[model samples]
Target: MKLKSFLSNLPARVILLIYSVIVLYPLLWTVTTSFKTTNEFYENPWSMPKSFQWTNYINAFKEASIGSYFVNSVLVTLLSMAICMILSFMAAYVISRYDFKAFRWMKKMYLVALFFPVAFKIVPLFQLLGDMHLLDSLFGLVLAYSATTIPFTIFLMAGFLESISKEYEEAAMIDGCSRFGVLFRIIAPMARSGMITVAIFNFMSYWNEYIMALSFITTESKRTLTLGIAYLMEVQRYATDWGALFAGLVIVMIPTLVLYALLQRKITAGINVGGLKG
Candidate 1:
């Protein structure tokens, strides 16, 4: 029995180790390359640098408007996430709790929208934004991001909300709580896990978003990290600065890693709870 149990777990552990190495290797390589000089990197592509060149990171920030890009990305991502959460939560609650005539149709519409690709709407979106005079603005990007994220956020939140017992709301009403009060004080608390799950998903999507940011943000200083990183590749065409490029890649990756480290546990728990209903 003991031997069987050990054998059963061994394969899973080995697979986990292999997957971890596969995911981490590129990140490790990028960080190591960032510390190498350009010549050293070409000569020893796979080896660690003999001397750590911390100046590459400094150069990356000085040469590129990395600081400004970072701030823009953060602001846009946060604003979009906040707006998406509130709008999705309210919409999901209505869809889940109400027995209106169009509730079923509304639910189906949102689900269908979730399957549609953003690329399909690009032309129309661009025209609309142009007409609104929102072209090439961070605020425009934020609005677009929020709109794109809402369908998925509503879908996920609706699933979680549907799983909740309506009795909780009724009980609150008996205690003289207003609908808004019950939602804010009780139902929202119960849906915390789902909210966190949606927030994390939206954050990751917006933070790494490249296509829309590329299309909408024209000014160099207004570009997001992904856009700024692309400029490094363009510069490399003239003379390859692999060290500086890798340094920039590392800088871009740090925020994402830090965010995941901070919120991964909450995200996992939220996913587990949310999946129970779906």
Candidate 2:
């Protein structure tokens, strides 16, 4: 029995190891490539640098306006995510706790919104933003991204909230706690895992968002990381700097990697707990 159990687990372990390598190799290559000189990168694209060119990162920042883009990206991501979480939490709480005639319709409406493709709405959204005098602005981009993300975030949060027992809220109410008080004191703490997961998801989405930011933010300094990376591609048209480009790529990837590493456990736990309860 022991031998059979060991054999059964061996294939899964081997597969996991292979998968991990596959996922990590591109990141490793990007980091190593960032440290290679341009000549070295061209000569040995597949191998590590003979001598690391640490100045590539400096060049990327100076030449590509990576510092400006990095700050813009951080601001956009943080603001959008903050709005998404706050709005989604409130919407989810209402949908989960309240009994109303419009509840079913509201859920269906959110589901429809979640599944709808943003491409279809681009023209109308642009027109609307133009009318509102919000075109080519970061605030407009924030509102757009928040609107796009809210449906799904609300859905996830609502599902998680629905899984919680109503008794907690009832007990809080019996003790004369207001609705807001119950939410902040009892429900929000319990829903911390789900909130973290939603925050991470929203952050990732906003960080890598390209099309909306590109369309809404025309000013050079206002461009986010994705647009900045794209500008690097354009700059390479006349003078290609593979090392600097890779360095910029590495910089762009760091925040995402760090965030995932920090929140992965909470994300998994949230999904698991929400699933079991729901």
Candidate 3:
């Protein structure tokens, strides 16, 4: 019986193995190619490098000025995420705990907003930012990112908040905790995993976002890592510095991979808890 069961699953396992290779091959190729010299790449694109070219990363940072762009991205993403999380937490707490008509309507509105694409808001956002003198500015970009992401963030947060028992808040209140204190010290900590899950999702979205960055920012100094990579690709088209281009890509991918690897367990637990309770 055991042998028969194993034989039945063999085809499915083989198919999954093939699918994994197909998915991972491009990523593997890009990493290997980043370490290859121009001549080595041209000679045989499929072959690994004889020696790792650390200079490719150096050129990407110094020549392409990816360092500055990286700083700008970090600033923008962190600021936006901070703002989005704080606001989303407060709003979700209210929407989840309060049974008022206005809060219910607001919840529905946010849910409806999630269905609309970001591209739909481009014209109005551009006009609004231009009027506010925020166009081409990093702060403005942060605000735009925050606003666009809030609806979904709130949605996720509300689910987690709903899962949390009101008894915790009530007990804290009995112990002389103010509403804000209960929220910050008790509720926030209790929902820690959910918060991290939402944050990681937002980080990836804010980090890799290109269309909004391209549309809003015109100044080279305010460019994000995504913009820097796009510009690097354009430069590579003429200069053919494929090594540096791939190196830039690797730089952009590192943070996300590291963050995911570290918090993957939290992501699974948070999603499961939120899904089941909410």
Using TM-score as the measure, the top candidate is 3
Q: Which candidate number would show the highest lDDT if scored against the true structure?
A: 3
lDDT (10s digit) by residue, model 1, range 1-278: 99999899999999999999999999899999999998898797999899999988887888766778889999999999988899989999999899787987888888899887878767777888999999999999999999998988988898888878999999999999998998889889999988887887788899899989888889987899899899878988887667888888998888778878998888888877763353
User: Cα deviation in Å at residue 211, candidate 2?
Assistant: 1.3
lDDT of 3: 0.93
- In order, candidate lDDTs are 0.87, 0.88, 0.93
lDDT of 3 at 144: 96
Give me the overall lDDT of model 2: 0.88
Error of 1 at 234 (Å): 0.9
Tens digits of per-residue lDDT for model 3, 98-156 = 99999989999998999998899888999999999999999999999999999999988
Positional deviation of residue 73's Cα in model 2 after best superposition, in angstroms: 0.8
Output the worst ten-in-a-row residue range by lDDT, candidate 2: 269-278
List of clashing residue pairs for candidate 2:
none
TM-score of 2: 0.95
Candidate 3's clash total is 0
Candidate 2 or 3, higher lDDT? 3
Report residue 8 deviation for candidate 1 (angstroms): 2.8
Candidate 1 vs candidate 3: the TM-score winner is 3
Which has the higher TM-score value, candidate number 2 or candidate number 3? Answer: 3
